[model samples]
Target: MNRNDTLVPQVFADGFDPARVDRSRYFLSLLDEGRAAGLFSEALFSLRMNELMERLAEQIGLWTNGRSSSVMQETAEALLNNLLYLLDLALSAAPEPRAAAAMLARTPVFPLYEAGMLAARRHLDRCRVYELALKKFEAMVLLPPGPAHFLHGGLRLWLDERDLRFNACEELYVPSSVFGRSRRLRGVAEAEAALAELCERLRSNAAGPV
Candidate 1:
């Protein structure tokens, strides 16, 4: 596919805020490096994209007097899925900057394109760990005061369901839960560590190649 010449090659190019430019460049650079290493996934991308979409939805929701807009939600989901496919394809190719032009020409860069890299690169077949961690997350939520704590990039209990308050952060989900007394992770470090261990576990199928 021919690269779009009109593309900005970067996300934040307002040219007014130096800090924004620098920060965006840093993230874009991380994406380039991370993509080269094959450490990116559609799930991670969706997580970040949804966060942005949620915020946008909130503002637009206010304009519409708190009315729920399923259309906007659906549109965001579709866009994220398409973007995920494009990033997966572009990163797979791993092309270099062949030539520079007088003007800055770049493709659209998303915020978590770098974060999607820094976070868990893939969703493994060993979902057992996520299953267990989710149980932990559930137990925490069931506690008195209704637990609210950090898990990875975001927080928990965004959506409530029958017997289980779920949607902890973006990348997590809890469909249902069971009553069980178990040792739950207490600290942020502990929770993050356990999540990392589970999400990073390599599946036998995904081990061979990118």
Candidate 2:
């Protein structure tokens, strides 16, 4: 589904003039806004994915028949964009999160997306994808609250950046004690409290020693 040999740094919308807008960047921005607001719908994801796939297919066919630089570049960028979006959709639709420990034991596709992102190495896309990926897991863990939830590597890095500084492997046994691999987080209130405590510890960590 990804073809990096032909990716460009920017892609415009299906109909928008590239001279006027970078559609790939624009679409990604919208995805960011949607994810942040916890406002995703299967309908929207389906519609957008369909539209992008069609355009990508056309570009691939064109390039296949006639080696067009323009076509190849568009296809490459769009492919990575699609994966990023698809992962977002999956995270949003997780009406169920696996056992918290199960998640920590192995991230589902976080690593895959992170690797594909190397192919998506255009500066702008790079800036956005990791954060988006982490945000997806963040949103997933913060769901109405249920079993003990765990943060995978990407999500853990995200929390750390936001001043939470959890050890992806250890959480310094701090968050591990609070949000460890058990069904400890019985509800949202507890989860929120734990996150608050993590933030406080991060502040202290920042202020003390080294």
Candidate 3:
């Protein structure tokens, strides 16, 4: 039901006015404040998203060109997943995250959906870049969590400049701001470069005092 060109940046919000606000920082800040206020419930967020979808059914139908109900539903479901991913990123970035979450009732779902779509696409390309580099390191192993984790750590740092150094973590971190870059990046050249850098690091690790 969708064209290849229709696959726009998954991070671009449908109605966000970038001239008035920084898309990445704006959602990030609201997410921070909402979490501090004891919001961020997944169930509630899903429920709210459902309600938002119901309201947008007509618009969705128009976009889908009167496709079958099932196709439209599938489209809505995909969009919902994208929205949830966006919220997950925001909450993950907050300090002292609570054990529970509440719905972001005041949060605008439409813009969130748009942002989610954009994020999902950018994340895929970034992942593609990393996966390509990973193939070269399959035989290499390192201490504890192993080489894969270390390689991921490097990519995460490269993706987000706010970070000063590589910090290994269990969760995969995708920076919201990376999708905001003006330059378009496909994974090929980046993967080649990353592989070269990783090979250099491996050699350094294997080297002994002269």
Candidate 4:
């Protein structure tokens, strides 16, 4: 197929029919190659495109699941986290002339995006802990408040806060006790480790050849 014909197929391949993905990916790939060759403009463009793709993926995941999946829910959660990371990288790499002003202008969207990401992350963490707890031990351990319990409680609070903050924006609210337990048990270190692993995987995927 010709370039124009390939556009639609590529969009479909990426799990969407949005007309922009092809052009976005094309320019993004060019940016990537240019950056690899030490061109700053291409690097900047790649960052911008990455930010856009992260947002698009997030919306698609939300619309597709409506916050219902137990297993696939992590997919949505990871999208937000990945977006946040990409945004951070993009902002950092942005030229000094425009970076501060541009990020300041986007402050309003940032908080909402962050809250959504944290909420999803908390929920997914809890779900994972819930499953692990159920499988590993029949009953709760009676030791002093440990990693598991702490993770669980933190998730519970985070989830509650997210609901309160974003209730207006969200279509539905789904609570999971499992997520809370998972948060408590996992601890910040473990959570960070997992997040790092996920980010690495996503970066690998994103950086792979088109």
Candidate 5:
């Protein structure tokens, strides 16, 4: 089945046995083989797998009553176990082990700095997407949340910057004042700067002892 077609089953709402859903097992198998063959980057693959696991958790949560049956609990546990296993594998495959070790020998500050840089860059990208979406909040609200929350939140922050009291629940009725006026452009600029700084930090840190 296409990944996109993996719908949350109605049985989940009635609290069906999670063990009955075998597709996760199949996906895990595919991931394992992909990793073994080096057909995918471990970090990227782990991130994607984690996303899938999170979606699964969300579906299960929505479907099952808080008091899950034994099979449901077991399935949840299995999913958690699988996520952690993949995480461990991804961390073990980090590309800068030698550099990290050498940096550790030089200064405790280096590793922290390096990690900070990487995190900043990731946040910057996140913020940029957010800012863009914020600028087009009306257009954004029409799109589904799946991958768009990343952008949606950024736009919300922009509204916040403008002293605009926007609620996502209000949905798509953005006044021209909010979208057309130049008053809120500063938020976008600031977001851009923040993102740029994050990218610079990442580049600098990666070029460090690591």
Candidate 6:
């Protein structure tokens, strides 16, 4: 946790770089080191998570006027995953990985859960309009050569499934693809607009002009 202390050798100090090493192996090595240093405990983490899950499920049930236990449990699990995802983002962005891990270990679980829940609420509110837009987009079919032409034009678009594909001739890309440019969808409207533009292009190509 000290600024003066480097956690590992300089080679290992940098965060997970796929080109340099395997991601799972790198994280596993770090996890082993943290466990050895008493900075991590599977038992303690599990206990805290279990407690948080129960509390979250109960609270969600109350808000929903008592949903089935199975539904509440699944929802709580998803929220917990969201909280961990935020924690992962924090760790990845930290300049001091060792100190970040130490701080994470020292932090209480509920505060992190609360923060994640608040973030989810804000995101849902911001994207609410996009919800119906995405649904409508999903229902439409990208007739014939329209999809091919759109991608072949070197433009990128996000699908409702959260995958971004581009460069129609060579390959379709997913999140893990090492090639092509990437952009996060600002909202469902962005994707919907892209599809609408593609459809309009099809109409123009078919009819010559309006």
Q: Write the per-residue lDDT of candidate 3 for residues 1-210, one digit (tens) a residue.
A: 333122222332233222432233334443444334434344434545465566356445654565744454665655443334454443333342221122233335554445444444455455556555454545554222444554457555544432101111113332333222222332223333444544556556557455
Task: Encode model 5's per-residue lDDT on 1-210: one tens digit a residue.
Answer: 543223212121222222332332333443454344443345535555556555446434533543553345766665454333322222322344332222222222223333433443443456556455443543634433422453345445544443111111111222233223222222222445443443454345446784
CA RMSD (A), model 3: 15.3
Q: Stretches of candidate 4 above 4 Å error? A: 1-127, 130-143, 148-152, 159-210
**Candidate 4: tens digits of C-alpha lDDT, residues 1-210:** 532232221111122222322222232332343334333233344444555665656555554654643335665554444444333333333344233223422333344356535554554565455435433332434212343343445534543443222221222211233223232222222344443443344345456787
So what's the TM-score on candidate 2? 0.22
Q: What C-alpha lDDT, on a 0 to 100 scale, does residue 120 get in candidate 3?
A: 45
**Per-residue lDDT of 119 in model 5:** 41
Backbone clashes for every candidate come to 4, 4, 10, 14, 3, 0
Better of 3 and 6 by TM-score: 6
Output the worst ten-in-a-row residue range by lDDT, candidate 1: 160-169
Task: List model 6 lDDT by residue over 56-112, tens digit each.
Answer: 565556545675555555655554444454333334333454655454455444554
User: Can you tell me which runs of candidate 1 are displaced by over 4 Å?
Assistant: 1-3, 6-105, 109-194, 197-210
- Better model by lDDT, 1 or 3? 3
Local distance difference test values of all predictions, in order: 0.33, 0.36, 0.41, 0.38, 0.37, 0.40
Off by over 4 Å in 5: 1-25, 65-72, 75-210
Q: What is the Å distance of residue 156 in model 3 from its true position? A: 20
Alpha-carbon deviation at 17 in model 3, angstroms: 33
TM-score of each model, paired residue for residue: 0.22, 0.22, 0.33, 0.27, 0.22, 0.37
Q: What residue pairs clash in candidate 5, if any at all? A: 12-63, 130-154, 134-155
> Candidate 3 has what TM-score?
0.33
Q: Which numbered prediction scores highest in TM-score against the true structure?
A: 6
